[model samples]
Target: MCGGPSAVVQVVHVTSLRINNYGYLERMVPASPSTWMATFTRVVAQAAAGFRRSRRLFHPWGECFAGTITLLVPGTLGIREEYPCLVRLSKGLGFVGAVPDALGLAIRIERPQPWDVLMVSSAGTGVLGRLIITPSALWTRPCYSTLMPYQRADGELMWLHARALGGHTVSVRRNALTEAIKGAPLGFELLSGASNGAVHWVGELTLERTAEPGLSFDPGVNQVEYLRLYPGWLTAIRSSAYLGSRQSRGATLSD
Candidate 1:
């Protein structure tokens, strides 16, 4: 139930807890060793206007879109395919306005081993706009950072990149970035390696919006075998952040 609206059937619910909607800060237990989780959860609760399992702290701004995507895995990793996908775009914060916030993208593929990708805005130039999150106009042409180190099959640590391929002519709107996506088809790619080295095209994704509710995306659970999480302090902190967010909202972490 956590990976997307379409993921509802696969949600593995654990024991639950009840929390006071307005007392998130007071009742939230530390999800990790870092003290940042407490402050982060408090800040997010304020932005979201309350504590509830229905929303996220960072990346709370959400819009559903659809497209076709291709996944180009390294031959050594043994994965490659093309599929129809659902995409969600949002600001990585609970701010209620068109103000600057980290932009995020989540793609969910409904295949045998449902794959999910979550990306955050990054700095660069192309048909894709700015990589940093600032109080500029929201455009579909933005590039998002995979924001984590990916472990290749050979145990190499790599980063990922995804740039939007549509909605360049649309204007920014207030309270919603949907205008950046309406009536426009969207697509993106996932690449590994670095410019200084042998870069590899690993995955491609296209997305569309629909009347049907999309599946909820939980990066903690929805993952592919080839694209593995990096091992390090940052990843640990990120896991803590997710745990902190879930605790504040009175939700269980997915298996």
Candidate 2:
């Protein structure tokens, strides 16, 4: 287990991650599918069709919101401060209406050189649970993970995690995400590292308002100068997906 909310951890990269007390030896992180290039092209086209031709490949139908993410894990995540941000809450697999799907949270911290954090619903606990993507039925008190590792600016590998604060449950229906938080803010506990070893509580991510839509978040392109989304192959796949989606939809970046 980790220390108190105010505790600071000395972060380092090792060959394993322990989720919920289970010591899991780190395994090779897969970045792309088999025969990725040709396969990826076909996947993008299929995704476009799956999303009704004008939506993103995965989180095609999402509502963008304005909020802030307070980063406070210190050494591992760099520093602590509240940053103005834009958040898009969506369902993975491009499913429409009320349905179980991998809940996606894409956050873009506003800065001269902003940082994009893309997380999907996952157990973030057991080996299989952490590796496989799961569609969450509810949004309250749920766990989300990077599903892969990223190298900190200092070259330390770590995974970013988030959890909805207690008593914040909401439905999975279309537009229910922003609706449920009209009066109460949708909050998350930002974390770094894994529980089996040393988990650092980064801070809170609070999404409060439903803003006017039309923002496309491309994590591969809009990231802090040199933030490395590690396991190079995955980055390539992600880059291709994001690029293809935007090109197909004729979308542009927005705040």
- Alpha-carbon RMSD to native, per candidate: 12.3, 17.3
lDDT, candidates in the order shown = 0.57, 0.69
Q: lDDT per residue, candidate 2, 106-224, as tens digits?
A: 88889877778888888764444555677876866457887777776677777777888866668888778778878778888887774343667778989888877767777766766
Global fold similarity of model 2 (TM-score): 0.74
Q: Which candidate number has the best TM-score?
A: 2
Residue 34 Cα positional deviation in candidate 2, in Å, after optimal superposition: 16
lDDT of 2: 0.69
Runs in model 2 with CA error above 4 Å? 1-43, 50-54, 73-79, 125-128, 194-197, 225-227
Q: What is the lDDT of candidate 1?
A: 0.57
Report the C-alpha lDDT of model 1 over 1-255, residue by residue, as the tens digit.
566576435432211122345643243443435556544653565456545434565665466766777766467465777787777776565455555566677777766777667777766422222234433345455556665656767777666667655445432344244544455545566666542335556777665544233245656456678767776566556656665666555555221
- Against the hidden reference, what TM-scores do the models get? 0.65, 0.74
Q: Which candidate is the best by lDDT?
A: 2
Model 1 earns a TM-score of 0.65
